[model samples]
Target: MRYVKWTFYTLIALTVFAFLHYVLPQHDIVRITNTDTRRIDFGENSIFWASPDAGTGAAQATRDVKFIETIQQNGRPMVYRNEDTGWIWPPYFKFNSYNLQTEASDLRSTSADPRWVVVTHYGWRNEFFTIFPNAVAVRLAEGPNERIIPWTNIVILTLLAVAGIMLRRMWRQFRERTLDPLFGTAEEVWEDAGDRAGAARRGARTSWGRFKAWLRSLGS
Candidate 1:
């Protein structure tokens, strides 16, 4: 049971970690190599994609998704989709897909004379599943080796930690003031009942011994 409880807790922690990792904005310093748009058909991977452009209805199961292709500082290829979140979950509130695409296209560079930029995005790039991270914003970087501090992530995580601590403290206080006292009272009652039962058994045994002695005296 203890192992099972720990396993359950570990699973919950991993799930939360995965959720935050996918939803939170991440920074990547890369050189924009190309920008293009592709028509994608919705399938099982549709949930990974955002909704239609802002103020537009869902017209069809397929739409043109803009993409920004880049080369990382390590020379590996990376691709990101540009789309409007449009009042959806994760709440990036991004309605500037076209603008971002233009910016990315403007920042496009070649390997010989690369212009590094920081791409703020969320989601994972999986080739087997054909899923790409959605780029939220882009900005010029100082250099290829720019040390970007994830201040947003740090602030969000700190607030979450503080909230968790506060919740735990509240639960402990509730248990101490309410549940613990109720259970403590019940436990005391149970111990008192056990003591009374033991005493009654001892009294009955003494009376039986006295009756046997009286019977033996009368027989003699």
Candidate 2:
């Protein structure tokens, strides 16, 4: 009975835990949607342009311009955009500021007059800083679904529930075994022993008196 009680309680506790784990989102993947530019105060007197992307906006702008020249290079999508002006890949823009900077520096070193080198690098850098943060925010805002539950977590929870039930049963069985010897049939056994002890005392008293009489007779 004790074991049963514990087992029931353990099962209840484990069931609650399992329910919570199942209901709560653990792993989530968010899709990027739209990109927007914003002006932010970065302390001091310096002002910078930042671009952020929207994850769930339907009215995002779509540009049909080919940024990458080769659509398929080694069967993989290659970036082919205008060499002079970098394009935004809405919702999933690549951080091409570093690449732009390298390209601008090379152009300056090779050419007699550096044209739009600095301007191109600055543009790419500004977009990279802004859009990356926005995309991250959108990803964070998205929630996880039930299908994302890990198999290991499920198995662990199931085992915990089973162990709780088993432990409760074992405890109950142990309690019953301990109580059966002392309370189940031991009452009758104790009563019989008490009666026998009384009879033994009465017989001893009578035998003592008979022995005294026999000794007095021999003396006379």
Candidate 3:
């Protein structure tokens, strides 16, 4: 019985650990916008340089000129251009254009941009690359989705509920085994105690008799 109790406690501890490792970290649901344009495009000379005569020069020209113009108009393009890579934008680029005041409040409230954007520049030889906008390269706490209860979370919680039920059943069984004799009209424990007491008394008498015999023999 003691071993069983220990085993159950150990299992409970393991379950708690698993819950912490897998479940706790997943408490908040991550709702990503699933933006369509978030992708890495690569190819041979896909990056075209603007003509030297063009405004902003060849260095400033980008294949995604239209997209950049749209972003610039909004004053929050969240668009990144790399000389090596064409155009890069977070999945949230479209959200910036939405008229928040006119759209459904829920949509406006829920929209968000990705927390971070990374731009990598690869050399023509593909041997070396650099990231641009070095001064403000990193953005934190800007992901597009809010946390929602994930399915894994639901499954873990269900398992925990089942475990709780099993624990309750075990407790009932344990109480029946330990407390029935004391409070459930069962005389088995009292009877066993009385039998043990009688045996102890007999053992004491036998010991006394043996001690007397030993003393008499010593005197003789």
Best by TM-score: 1
Q: In candidate 1, how many Å is residue 176 off? A: 1.0
With candidate 3 superimposed using the best TM-score fit, by how many Å does residue 54's alpha carbon deviate from the native? 51
- lDDT for model 1, on a 0 to 1 scale? 0.95
Per-candidate local distance difference test: 0.95, 0.38, 0.37
Better of 2 and 3 by lDDT: 2
TM-score of each: 0.87, 0.25, 0.26
Of the candidates shown, which would achieve the greatest lDDT relative to the real structure? 1
Instruction: Give the total clashing residue pairs for model 1.
Output: 0
Once superposed on the true structure, which residue ranges of model 1 sit more than 4 Å away at CA?
194-220
Task: Look at candidate 3 and tell me the lDDT of residue 197.
Answer: 95
Candidate 2 vs. true structure, TM-score: 0.25
Off by over 4 Å in 2: 1-25, 31-146, 185-220
Ranking by lDDT: 1, 2, 3
Candidate 3: how large is its RMSD?
17.7
lDDT of 2 by residue, 70-153 (tens): 111123322212222213422224344335334423433212321221111111213334311111111122122323445655
